[model samples]
Target: MSVQAPRWRAMRVSDLPAASAVAARVHPGYPEDDAVMAERLRLCPEGCLALAGPGDLPFGYAVGHPWRSGSVPDLDTLVGALPVPAGAWCIHDVALLPEARGHGAAGEVVGLMLGEAARRGLPEAVLVAVGDAAGFWQRHGFRPVPIAAPAGYGAGATVMVRSLAP
Candidate 1:
């Protein structure tokens, strides 16, 4: 039997359960309500994606939305709405199961998110790098900015930014 590798695709409402499972498994220290993710998808479907394996089951998910820069949303809380005339792309979260790691899926989704942001004419991308994820974000052209990350992001969370300008 041939095994199929996971691939990135548009996230669907049905995938929320799996996405939440992946989040719980990958980031126990940082928990987010499934409704928060659902709101993001509803608010900006273009910025929501899932890494699907066989049977189209999601093993990882990425959620982003339009928002102001230099600000980090409180973890697990719903934004209620995305900002109009949004100034930047806020990469809310990206979670991958251990089995889904080392396949470049995360990086690929990041690139895709950045592309979406650029398509929307956003000038930059921002995210809170939790735990040891700062290095990973740094490798993706996101530099740790001087902004104060929320304490709800857990210890060692760093606010990172990457300019999407050419």
Candidate 2:
């Protein structure tokens, strides 16, 4: 019999550690610290998502919030607060374990985020594609932007943006 896929759900206060585990596994260098992840959840729990498997740990996690598009948030640090009139939806972190890769799960999670952006009346979505993952974001309709990535994100880190469908 074929195995079932994990289900996507809103990230809650209880999922912090599991989410951190997944982030640490997928993003070893640019670790999104537990405190930073919690801050993102606080900024917009509705935008943060977790893929729950049969076990306690999450299969993947996508954390984000609406923020000003002119700048990117620091790597692995706390964003004290989102701007009062955030202009675009910023995808802060997305991580998936090996078993969760090459599946439709990531795309589905991004769809949920885009839907949230549209619902919030945000015109755009932005993210810093690390390493060679720019192609993945490009496939999702995000094009490279001139915005500079913050220090510690590595040399290949580049900002990308796309308009959300209203």
Top candidate (lDDT): 1
CA displacement after TM-score superposition, residue 132 of candidate 2 (Å): 1.2
Model 1 ranges off by over 4 Å: none
Q: What C-alpha lDDT do the candidate models reach, one value each?
A: 0.91, 0.85
TM-score of each: 0.97, 0.94
Segments of candidate 2 deviating more than 4 angstroms: none
TM-score, candidate number 1: 0.97
The ten-residue window of minimal lDDT in model 1 covers 68-77
Residue 75 miss distance in model 2 (angstroms): 0.9
Residue-pair clashes per prediction, in order, are 0, 0
